[model samples]
Target: MKHTVQRDWRVTRPSRKSRFNFDQTTALGGLTVALFTYIIYHFIYPLISKGLLW
Candidate 1:
């Protein structure tokens, strides 16, 4: 008597194609916006409020 093994196709399919990385893109965009806002509020706003930046 002999035995054989079977494999499932679904387990290996994702390796062939990359899934859309929307999560990463969104997180990066949010971080960039936060950084820009922080810079404007902390550095630029202070200068403007003091009537030094023009």
Candidate 2:
């Protein structure tokens, strides 16, 4: 029995330094905002509601 494995891969030498992709940047920005809001909702909102923080 003969088994053959097919591979598809490519390697390239980039001519210039790659910048952050736009879609990735947007996704990161959204994640950051969501985390920040969640932090406030989880920790800071409770403090304010109980009159412990202004």
Candidate 3:
């Protein structure tokens, strides 16, 4: 005679505070920084260069 054990169909996964992934967060952060840099370079820099922002 042999004994067998059954496992749950759903494997338990590690819990998280949020569903957002770290990779996505990093990607979004990078994109945001890039956008800000572009804005500053193309738009704000001209104002600063002409001393219009002062």
Candidate 4:
């Protein structure tokens, strides 16, 4: 006896524009980096430092 399974697949279509708007992407990336840095310094850095020392 043979059994067959059914599956559904989905594909995402790409945008037609070949060139990216770098200015917006770069600005958003910079903001994200700044926010991540602030959080790490405020919360994570102290914990890591204490772990390393003791």
**Best by the lDDT measure:** 3
Q: Pick the candidate with the highest TM-score.
A: 1
After superposing candidate 1 on the true structure, give the runs of residues whose Cα lies further than 4 Å from its correct spot.
Answer: 1-22
In model 4, the worst 10-residue window by lDDT is 6-15
1-54 per-residue lDDT for model 1 (tens digits) = 678676664665555455755578899999999999999999999999999999
lDDT of 4 by residue, 1-54 (tens): 778775645446754665765578899999999999999998889989889635
Candidate 2 clashing pairs? none
lDDT of 2 by residue, 1-54 (tens): 889775745546645556955578899999999999999999999999999997
Per-residue alpha-carbon lDDT of candidate 3 for residues 1-54, written as tens digits (9 for 90 to 100): 888777676648966768776788899999999999999999999999999998
TM, every model: 0.59, 0.56, 0.57, 0.47
**Candidates ranked by TM-score, best first?**
1, 3, 2, 4
Q: Which stretches of candidate 3 lie over 4 Å from their true place?
A: 1-22
Q: How much lDDT does each candidate structure score?
A: 0.85, 0.85, 0.89, 0.80
- Looking at candidate 3, the ten consecutive residues that score lowest on lDDT are 6-15
Regarding lDDT, does 2 or 4 come out ahead?
2
TM-score of structure candidate 2? 0.56
Residue 37, candidate 2: C-alpha displacement in angstroms = 0.8
